[model samples]
Target: MLDFAIFAVTFVIILVGAVLYLYPSSRRASGVPGLYPTDEKDGNLQDIVNKGSLHEFLVGLHQEFGSVASFWFGGRPVVSLGSVNHLQQHINPNHTTDSFETMLKSLLGYQSGMGGGANESVMRKKLYESAISNSLKNNFSTILQVVEELVGKWSSFPEAQHIPLCSHMLGLALKTVTQLGLGERFRDDAKVISFRKNHDAIWSEVGKGYMDGSLEKSSSRKAHYETALSEMESMLLSVAKERKAQRKQSVFVDALLQSSLTERQIMEDCMVFTLAGCVITANLCIWAVHFLSTSEEAQDNLYQELQDVLGSDPVSLDKIPHLRYCQQVLNETVRTAKLTPVAARLQEVEGKVDQHVIPKETLVIYALGVVLQDADTWSAPYRFDPARFEEDSARKSFCLLGFSGNQTCPELRFAYTVATVLVSTLVRRLKLHQLQGQVAEVRSELVSSPKEETWITVSRRS
Candidate 1:
């Protein structure tokens, strides 16, 4: 209740201030090609989402309207950039635009006053980069320890034990992030459990707001959301207080605490990091296992590469790049799995991409899932062939947009380190096999995940 009250007050003040300052500039219209189709007779756009064919729908739109097209969302023009050229033009590396902030604010209903400005965003990004960089280099000890713990658990499972990959991976990711990001070790702590509950509660409500204020429309949901946010905030606040008191720390939260951001702002970042870190890393690991388990050739090649690089020695950050096949396998997993299907940027100025004129304030989106599988760029697009990435030239293609491209998020970069360590450690000892009866299918969420419970059996390789 207190959190909601504080938020409500801030929301009102920011809303009024925005109306006075930003409304005039935000009223510009973009003249783009395609609009979200609406039924002429009923004056309602077709609810294509109900059919669970959003990916097919997006492909159809691109095919029909060309690379750059527009859709109407709540009377605002959202331009979808479908091709690599369009993506490069719109999400240029030189631009200082922060797409992640735009995404969090627009999609998550984050108020502008809560860590929204360019400078604040930069501070947060710098802090994240610094923490991850330091941890990646200096904290390999912690990472290996966590991975060994995970391996022990897997090894203890009985032979042919059907392990639910998603749940297990989630736990591993949670533990890893808690240790690396928070500068604290967590092993089923009550506070950790509370944090997970809140983290899930908040994510479950994504994309549900903004429909006539639907987040607050249901009192029960509003209460639940408020409680979750409050609990998460409280947990982080306590951590922050303790970390601040003891000035000796080297974690992401410590970096954040030293920054100019307030405690609430730091909490917001911790929450975002949890979402970004845990889900993406988990999906990457799960998908890597999924593809490798099914493809004997890829598994053999990856094992050979690991052996060639490590040679019975343990995996470390220093050796990740030398294991080229492992990188290829992971890259192929990202390309085939399409964990994050789209990335969006809000156009701050009128822009021209190819022949399309994108107006100011338009939400420019990159359709990664469609482009990654584009037949023009990828041969045998649907096949899980890690060998496709064997040639550096093939990997250079812009289709792998999320992590490898110019638009790579820091979270994904951090995920690579975590995923590399886990994959290297696990595959070195255990031979993974997919359960024969269950056919894995891709399901779309905020991130992509397997539709069914992905069960894999671990057998001793040596």
Candidate 2:
């Protein structure tokens, strides 16, 4: 889901490509009410930068123009839908693939047809689906083991010690994703640490690089990025080779092996799942724990749920789904954090929303952040209330916002499970509390990370 932000910063160029020549940026074209380009070439991109992020810009744009609004994204008139009704109309019934994955394809410059035809696409689709499905289902124990190990590590920390919440969560996510997706090689801490080091290097560069055009301006920074990327890809390639030779069909890599996807496609797919998966899982845990630390009532409720459903037993896959409140806590965290704030879809055919007529190929922004906080949809939209999810209407609203429902992305579903298991296990043994006067601001990057590391203290429960 980081694709929703990382590639989005560059989408105007990557997605539209040469379309700027076909349609002039000056023309508003449709009845959609919105802003026109302030500059001849850059469109409203400067205004977006001035407003902070695309998410923030959309917030103001929708406030001024209502649910459906248009803005210039680098010489292209892009329309954004900020209400549930608008999104319902935009939802494509037949396009079943994840919307963010399509953005990823644009980022990787991968053409679905270029690798193979319709039959091959179908096979690869099955492989992708089964890879995530069977990997999580078949390897649930492995995921639980990793979660237990992290709980074990935390249990060892001195009582009332300040824990680096962000760092520990990120490390845990990387380890879980690697071992489950590739193989047991990641069971060794050194390999996982190495991957983490290189990933940190690459992640910092890629997120900031595209945002400010620094990746291209600084040669050394770009070199380090490529080097880190190469190392990460090489590690995955080694796993792919080993899995292929063994003819293993157990996890994600093996599932991809069953398909005729080129080596490049396999690597890219692996990269997407691992990289995006890690950030999402890490941030989800960080925010969930942070939010819990600040709310004693919610913490008590969650702990009670764990006690009722799990008791003193270790977390098992069978019981994970039974932790209803646990899922709500995470859903509220995602809604509050706006982890993936914005996502866009290409208008394959001319579409209409209200009185607006969308031209073919026009980029339709989801403006998810705006809708996530819209007063009309949510009660006290800014409050961190997991209990809101207790209502069926609230759950339906979340699905309409594209965070859940039948269309939930595999990465998120995976993150939710891993996070629930880990958080459940920890809360069962220890009490979590916020540091006095300790507050952290949201970065709203790749996937809503804390602007700086957020620290918390833990003590054994009485």
Candidate 3:
């Protein structure tokens, strides 16, 4: 017993010494400024994980640590910023390609050295000039067709059958975006349906793994993510191959194939474009409906605006601009429920932000959710007021970075048109109800959603 006790005591002492030696004691030692507070004395990696929501915790960190602060994310030195001014200073078109490409590669699971920088640039330029540039104008008919199909489906739902608004909206958005990008309807098609089911399942698991800190070094999670991404790529590549064989040049796949890019690169860009547009636009529609339902006055006013402008003419593409109130409502929805809450960049060269010197290759994260909701920039930041965007004074700051500016995703114009049409169609014909026990909660990931299960009641407008 004495020998065992002695061994145990010595082991405990060695463990303590190791921890003390390994743990960072000061901000400078941690490669961060001293202004930011660290819980190094009491906190561990598990403590960081236990904090409520990752998004909320990150926001709090930025609040406590000013615009530029550092935190240890799984042993990585994560530099965070929450000001638009700071983001604008760091992320410009000239310096954003590396960070953007890194994220794209990670998301698409692309192999390095497969495509050179010059080829990637040429492909990006072709994608921008061809598919993205023509998306808004070219996809108008497709958007309308998708919206009409969705409206027709919703019109059949009786008053007793309260539709799951978010799911339906997501389905509609996914279908519309896929149809627009691929020039084929894949929403309910058997192969596409299975692909979506598997893709969503994998992403859900991956999200859980990330939040639980199990994604890092977890071979199972890594395999799951890779499989999901691979399946998505395979589906897209098959479609691209078919389109090529047919000499079809209607959608993004066609443009991608024609560009100076490999099949893998084309697949990556397609996946990014499709996923970005589908998720954000769908969530926006869901939130817009929720806001309109909760606020009767706003809904009535919006319905009146739609009626006055559209007047039962099925919301023509040309008439989208006239529905000013609908646009404001959409903008307010984006401001309140930021779809893309955080934007990240890596510093390429040493630069000074405010008084601090930021080193090269340092990861910088800008909290768009915090900045958009900052009281200094917005009045009654928590309120759902669409009228704030009606006046010219308020309109100047209306750019909420939904699609961002310098590193703006190419699909914004297409998303805007599709969202405008869908919202206008619904508001004109339907009166939505806030279902019992339905409350809006933000779900954070690559994009945001209204909690896990958000349901709203809809009835045809009299």
Number of the candidate with higher TM-score, 1 or 2: 2
| Candidates sorted on TM-score, descending | 2, 1, 3
Tell me model 3's lDDT, rounded to 2 decimals: 0.62
Minimal lDDT window, size 10, model 3: 1-10
Whole-model lDDT values for every prediction: 0.67, 0.76, 0.62
* Model 1 CA lDDT for position 73: 41
Model 2 scores a TM of 0.91
What lDDT score goes with residue 275 in model 2? 75
Sort order, lDDT high to low: 2, 1, 3
Model 2, poorest ten-residue lDDT window? 1-10
- What's the distance in Å from true for residue 86, model 1? 2.3
Clashes of 3: 0
What is candidate 2's lDDT per residue for 37-75, written digit by digit as tens? Answer: 898877787787787767777889998989998887666
Question: Which candidate wins on TM-score?
Answer: 2
Model 1 per-residue lDDT at 267? 71
Q: What is the TM-score of each candidate against the true structure?
A: 0.87, 0.91, 0.82
- Per-prediction CA RMSD (Å): 6.3, 3.3, 10.2
